[model samples]
Every structure is written in structure tokens, then in C-alpha cells.
Target: MIVAFSVTPLGVGEEVGEYVADAVRVVRASGLANRTDAMFTTLEGEWDEVMDVVKRAVEAVEARSPRVSFILKADIRPGVTDGITSKVETVERHLAEG
Candidate 1:
């Protein structure tokens, strides 16, 4: 299964990329998944593996900063997952169905 998830803020800024990097590092270190890049990443594993990545990402950006007000959205999917971009597509499909 592929699950795509992301950690984003209210506004776009330099921190946006930082948060992604921080979270990706945690995921790679967890030994549950691999880190592809700072902004984009791909972790191959089961549901637990994917969830672990998302949890780490949440911890990485649970602060109230000037740019990062809060988590704008968090989406997960199956089959194959990337980062924010693919996750957004998953979201769009759900919205369209609704």
C-alpha cells in the first residue's frame, strides 16, 4: 500500500521546506522507512510504517510559528504514497466524490 501524507502551514515560507526536512529525517532515523529527499520522500512498508512517518511529521511541526500557524491538512492513501502533491490528489478525489 502507498500512503501519501504532508505537514503544511497556513502560509508558504522558507520554514515550509524546513518542516518537511525535519520530519523526513525523523522518519528515516526511525528505521521504518527511507528518506528520498528533503521536500519529497518515499517510504515502502506496511500500514504501521506509513503511520510512523506521519506521526513523526506531526511532531516536527507542532509549534506556533510566524509562517507555520497550524497543520493545514494531513492525508493518507494506499497503493503508493509520496508527499504533499500526491496526497493532495487523494484529497481531490475524495472531495469530487462527495
Candidate 2:
């Protein structure tokens, strides 16, 4: 499955890069198949492991701020792996063919 999520620390002013980085750090340290774009960090793994990483990431931000806003979207296909890169690669392949 592939899960894309974002963590925003609220009531902490306009610049929240540091807090966002805290969450991203947790995701990176997990060693999961992942990519962080401008808006979301996408992770590919089994259900438990992926959710655990997301939970830890939110906690990382929660530690710094009283309120945290987390948004998550998941493609929970049972028999899929490496969708993090493969999904994008598939789209690129199609575009190239055209």
C-alpha cells in the first residue's frame, strides 16, 4: 500500500518548516520506501509498519506544538509493493509512450 500524509503544527506561527522537518525526520529514519514532495510525504509498506511510521511522525510534531494537523490518504491495495516509485514510473512510462 501507499500512504501519503502531511503534518502541520498549528498555532505555531507561519513558518512551520522545523516542525514539519521533525515529522519528515521520523519518516526518513524509519527506512521505509518513501518520498517527500512539496506537500506530502508518501510511504510504501505493509499496513502496520506504514501506520506506525505515520503515528511516530505525528508524535514527533506533537512534541513541539500543542496542536497538530495531520492529513493522510491511502491506497490500500493488498498485493502491491514499491508503489511509491512504481506508480509514478508507470505514469511516466505511459507519457513516454505517447
- Output the number of the TM-score-best candidate: 2
Quantify all predictions' global Cα lDDT against the true fold: 0.57, 0.94
lDDT for predicted candidate 2 compared with the true structure:
0.94
lDDT tens readout by residue for model 1, 1-98: 44435556545555466666676677678765454544445555567766766676667765533344322222344565444355568899999999
Per residue, candidate 2 scores C-alpha lDDT tens digits across 51-83 of 999999999999999899989999998887787
Q: Which runs in model 1 stand beyond 4 Å of their true positions? A: 11-15, 35-39, 64-98
**lDDT leader:** 2
Error of 1 at 27 (Å): 1.3
RMSD of 1: 8.2
What is the Cα-based lDDT of residue 37 in candidate 2?
90
Worst 10 residues of 1 by lDDT: 65-74
Superposed Cα deviation of residue 1, candidate 1 (Å): 2.7
lDDT of 1: 0.57
